[model samples]
Target: MGAWFTHLILQLAAILGSSLVTPTPLVRTDSGAQLERDWGQQVRLKHLYMEGNSRHLQINPDGHIDSSHAQNFYTLLEIKAVERGQVVIRGVNTDQYLCMDTEGNIFGSTTYREDDCNFNEEQLETFYNVYHSPRHKKVLSLSLEKRPYIPNRELPPLSMFLPRENELPMATYSRRSSERETNDTDPFGMRSGQQASPKLSRSSRG
Candidate 1:
């Protein structure tokens, strides 16, 4: 009976042509969506340029988002794909995560909150992209007044951002320089002392 079973298994393997034990090949395609498709791959965005004022979106050391006149160190952002089509952005100079509120207010947070920090990057018709928060159901926008712009259901031009690639800056961010203690008892205050997002495999500090 054992010999008969072995012969049957061998016959099945022969008929299958070794496909049962062979692994399927993975084919990867590259395009403008490469950044979103490449999960865990980090990218340093030199200029998150918005067309409204022709200024770069800068995350200040105090965890505030503002428009800048030129490409500065504060405007340097390191973005990584957390999931397919979803990314978590961080300010390379301030050690803050780019976050958005339900009111469409964009800010930076020391602690990484998936609901606030994780954004679905949507590519627009103009070859630019707009970040949409699935949790808040709001889009990231910039006002001409250099303040937070509340976005309506209709995606405005202010929501579009052109990501241009350039060399990463050599300046390192000092966490100690901008450390602050705050309690998150309320829903608005999400700041905490976490080194990185729990979903990520490695430390985000680096």
Candidate 2:
């Protein structure tokens, strides 16, 4: 009986440990095949600027978001994972989150409002990130057109879907700095790095 009890306890422990393993948030090629070790690390994205224009995407003090040459704090972003593939890009300086309206207009908001700001961060062949909104939804992309940034729903000509004036560009971004201890943690969970991962499960009682 004693030996049997010990074996049962060992099995339970192994299952618990495996469940506790936290996966990384960053994807190597968006294939979801592999994950980087930095799950909660902070990262910066510089817009892929053209030759003569030297600017990164920034949110102005008035809450106007546009590409700018300045590489200040306003241009820095903290990526917050909302779910498996969805993330919200919040401006480090303004503390406001970036979201899109139903009309596909891009803007910054102080809080998340469901479909308004959530995006599927797609890594394209050009290595730039494309923030794709939901079906019948749109985001301001490299192509400044009215078309939604989803597959199969784009215009037939395909040229209209190409990068346009003031649209986000392919090879349009370069990532910088995976700072330590910058991960956003749950109020209930131990501080990042102290815990193997953030809260995988939640309770109402708290």
Candidate 3:
């Protein structure tokens, strides 16, 4: 019985030690795979181009949203994931959050109001995706005539936008520090002194 108890004690200690060890956390790098990738990163939304009506979600310095011309500086925005299928849009240049009022007024504000700014981001069967204000049942559209306020049922072609990478995502434009903690232990997220495999990513289906 004493030998059995001793063996049981060692087994329990081994289990406890394993539990204390932290597993590698899944990281979303710039070259992250689809399943591994997540939002809360900066991206640009580009609408279908027309001669007079090229639209991009641009925030003015005074906390106003414009869908007119694609302003290089102001068109960069960040989509932060709040919960599944929900996100909040914020302007990278103006430091403002994109919001929609119940009266169908689309604007940007320095303050973030959860209800006003929470939007449902969904990818369509096609190449484009859409942002809809679920609370107000309004679609954030970029129509040439009346912008950012179409009924969700209408589903205008211009309302959908293609996600694009920021051309010049500099540290100067961001609030966060430029420093990313180096993984001295294992930059490849594994044990050291082994043959490095080719950088891998999961190809996402369209």
Candidate 4:
């Protein structure tokens, strides 16, 4: 009788142990209309020119998404509604989720293993959408241009969103620099005293 009782107790303990380790399934309500009103279908994130560039955000082959990539098949994503105002950004092509970690770097996740990947989709008063990760409460942005020739090890783990400029400084700078170089140097590789003008005179026009 004592051996049988011991065996029963062991079985109960094993059952309890299994229950402790088991993860509880997420229970969702049938709020179809509510979900539709809040979360739209799969969409591509286009960079707001007022906030940054006009490029579209896309996940690269290495499993990182940024604004440097143009709108394409791999860049398309779905925004799924979660608890509260939070949501998950999933890549339609790769079937991975856009999640952040404790260090505040964003990456693609195959599973919902960390809470950092879930973000709060806060609509700013400026009518722009900002994604805030719960881990560090920092907003994610894709404003940096990709340098493909650069080595991966030398690159930063995450790219930061640059603030919007009234005019494109890079483009303007390149143009002005080219003009100065042309004006300073002649085609024969000699220093010119006067600026070279491409416009022809009226007599020369004939």
Best TM-score among the predictions, by candidate number: 1
lDDT of each: 0.65, 0.49, 0.57, 0.48
**Per-residue lDDT tens digits of candidate 1, residues 75-181?**
88766666677777877767788887656667777767777788887676677777878787677776521223243335655778887664444534334322432
Residue range 104-198, candidate 3, lDDT tens digits: 55677655556667888776566466777877767776453333434344474456766666665566554331232146332212223113332
Error of 3 at 1 (Å): 46
- Stretches > 4 Å off in candidate 1: 1-32, 35-40, 144-153, 167-206
- Which is superior by lDDT, 1 or 4? 1
Per-candidate TM-score against the hidden true structure: 0.61, 0.52, 0.56, 0.46
Candidate 2 residue-wise lDDT at 173: 30
Candidate 2: segments with Cα more than 4 A from true spot: 1-54, 142-144, 152-184, 187-206
Best-first order by lDDT? 1, 3, 2, 4
Q: What tens-digit string does per-residue lDDT give for candidate 2 at 102-191?
A: 666566765445555567655445433456676335644533565566654443121121111233332323222223234344321122
Query: What clash pairs does model 2 have?
Result: 48-172, 55-68, 55-69, 141-168, 142-167, 142-168
**Most lDDT-accurate candidate:** 1
Instruction: Please give the RMSD to the true structure for each candidate, in Å.
Output: 10.3, 15.6, 16.9, 22.4
lDDT for 134 (candidate 4)? 67
